[model samples]
Target: METSLRYTSNSRSLKIHAKEKLLVNSRTRLQLHGELDTGTGAPSYFCAMIRYFNPEALTILGLGLHYNKREKLRCLVRGKMEFPVRTGVPVTFNVKGRCDFDQEFNQRNPKGAAEFAWSVMNFQEDQSVRLKVGYEIFEKVPYMQIRENNWTLNANMKGRWNLRYDL
Candidate 1:
């Protein structure tokens, strides 16, 4: 179990944040987090979030929910899967998405990304360093056009090579 609180103030805004997390199992965790911001000229709002993380089979799953007066509500989901190869290492595929809830199912704001990566070395809990390379795409759709009660997704997709180091 873990808990924390933070408070910060600037010339224009003051912010407060708190978080609590509990380990449900060896590889599973549940958390609750919240934040509040208020000040002069800044729109005051409070946001709360809940998250869960765990490993299932050859995949890692993550789920979350965010709520606030500004955005109303949002949901997030992510999955990472590993496939064994002949080289004795595994290649990983990851996909993640976060979207705002709208009364109309076809019209929504969505942000999504995906990656395919493989580590240079076998990952281990005691290992201090690792490198990974992957190709990734990030897409965002802020507005959907409603035509004749049907909606279409308007998004821009950007793709790039991603190199990451973990220590």
Candidate 2:
């Protein structure tokens, strides 16, 4: 299979100046090695470590169909991710998000201290595939709290894969 992947990020208060394409191989392993442009400073660096859950556990929970039937399929992914400021200055808050795909798939808050949820879906078509991701960040501060006002960030990624099937 020949596959092409694309990624996009749209932020509300923060702006995604640039995004580097992720590289993956036939083994379904993802490797990240790139930089994203920032505003008025040096570009930010990206690094992540992801762990996938078992497919059988996911199927038992009715998350989705296990069509591939692979023993070690990826069900849930927990990422210990980091993104540094462009100017090498340490911000007051550290940003990190965790993507979980259990019975319910969701994305955690990026601030690493806030509580939030995010979800992404990958759909396959005849000759192409599309990935839609929605993220929400809810922050609660002392003296005042931002309750239900969820900040929305959406991304649409599309790609076409070339498959080599030996019948």
Using TM-score as the measure, the top candidate is 1
Report the poorest 10 consecutive residues by lDDT, candidate 2. Answer: 59-68
For candidate 2, lDDT tens digit of each residue in 47-123?
A: 33322333433211111111112222223333322333343443212233433342333422132232122222232
- Clashing residue pairs in candidate 1, if any? none
Error of 1 at 43 (Å): 12
What are the RMSD figures for all models against the true structure?
12.1, 18.8
Alpha-carbon local distance difference test for all models: 0.43, 0.27
lDDT, model 2: 0.27
Best by lDDT: 1
Show where candidate 2 strays beyond 4 Å: 1-30, 38-41, 59-167
Residue 68 accuracy (lDDT) in model 2: 19
Clashes in model 2: which pairs?
A: 1-162, 1-163, 1-164, 2-161, 2-162, 2-163, 3-161, 107-118
